[model samples]
Target: MFARDTDDFSPSERERIVKTAVSPRPVAWVGTRDAAGTDNLAPFSSYTYVGADEPSVLFTASRRDGDLKDTPRNAIDTEVFSVSVATADVLETVDHTAADPGPEEGDEFDLAGVERAECDRIDAPYVADAPIAMECTLHDRQEIHGRTMLIGDVVRFHVADEATRDGQVDSREITTIGRLGGPYYTHTDPVEFERRY
Candidate 1:
């Protein structure tokens, strides 16, 4: 095992270590509606799983980079957003959305050629092709280490029929893509292993 204190490393070095150590983070292809009602879409790998026992919730962290990224700002303004699961089929489009354009630039949906559909409960839109999507209302917002932590309460879930079975999701069926270090990505093909009880 190897580890180093973050204080001893430069920001870029720390980022590299963090991104690599986090191992295959699920990519959130999030969508939100701007003040002008235009649909904005982007992908973030800094997402975490919120437990099922509690209220249905998911966490996504975004930077307050001068309100340039539409997702965070729009969620703050409208109190709503959508989180869509990214898969290998849409990986290219997802990558395209991660590109940092100017604040005044048009929505990434147009640039990525991804179709968007209205979220049932929220004013924003969601990716039509995502195997699963959650319409979320803002639960809380806080600043953590210069990033905005947007905790959303899941209002509605849109899951593809093929991915759902016996009232649960089949991970193998969904085949979600995950982000790795640099430009690497991984698919959710399960590997069975016995857990020590």
Candidate 2:
């Protein structure tokens, strides 16, 4: 079934279509700091890997509200941030960070009880429990459909020893989690399938 561009869909219907269309988005447990050095952590499902080699990058799609979300705002202000991979173990804390708290609501890191570690190359902090964390500096920001698309150049990578093998990340060992439509999530594991080629 197809609807005309002019046709108006209810908010729920529109959300359903968009969420279903964007299947299996990776979660970015972003860490940032306000002017006062108040740590703000938030989990955004609208994130993706952008590049592979030197100047590797990750992009996050941040919706524009009247007030900018702490992650994008802080990243833009300080020009630095950290992106952490979410796992099933940290799902609860990650979800807590997604709450739309007021800017004056103090540090979410302390509120959620999530451990934080200083980023090696940036002033921002990274989630200590995450198996993987990437320190990044803001590369660019573009406005797309009123949403801010933040591109960050990765400067350093922090990988837990248990999650790495021979200089490579073992997905099964990392056990990262991804977001699904309507309060659903999935974890990584070993699964093999033959290529269609």
Candidate 3:
């Protein structure tokens, strides 16, 4: 057995340890609108549903050198966002959203070759390919200890007909993707995970 205090490691090193340790994290294909009203989409594995009782979701964004990225920046301005589930059917294109030529390049949705569907309750849009989508308005955020956590109130829900059976989501009908340790990802089926950075 081997163990060491993580406090001795650098931020990147700590992240590596933590990320690898947490297996099968849910991914959210987040959508936001920029200051120019241009649509922006990105996939984040660091996300989770706070609850639907009050209907909310929380996702994290990283900042460097005091600069906020497209997602968080637009989220701060518009105070709204959309979350589209990254299912197996559109997982490839969902990963494509991670590409970074630059924010000024163009809309990631168009770049990734996905259709944008209007959200019902929020000011944002969602990936049309998603089986389930949530329109959310920014509820609150916690900015502390060099981390920014974005929390949203889910105001509306969208369910593709095929994804639901008898008013309940049928998982067998829609295989969703999940993020594993590194560059590795997993589908609904069991697989021997590979390391990715």
Provide TM-scores for the models.
0.88, 0.88, 0.89
Q: Note the Cα lDDT for every prediction shown.
A: 0.82, 0.82, 0.85
Which candidate's TM-score is highest? 3
lDDT of candidate 1 vs native?
0.82
The pairs that clash in candidate 2 are: none
Give residue 78's error in model 3 in angstroms: 1.0
Residues 1-197 of candidate 3 have per-residue lDDT tens digits of 86889788998888877888886888999999876788889998889989868989999888868888789888888999999999876778888898764656668988888899988777788998788899989999888677689999988888899988887987767788988877888888635667797
**Highest-lDDT candidate:** 3
Of candidates 3 and 2, the better by TM-score: 3
lDDT of 1 by residue, 1-197 (tens): 86777798998888877889897988888899878887788888888756565545555555554453567888889999899999888788899997756657767887778888899888999999788999988888887777777878888999988788797888878888887887789988888877999
| Candidate 2 similarity to native, TM-score | 0.88
> Which of candidates 1 and 3 is the stronger one according to TM-score?
3
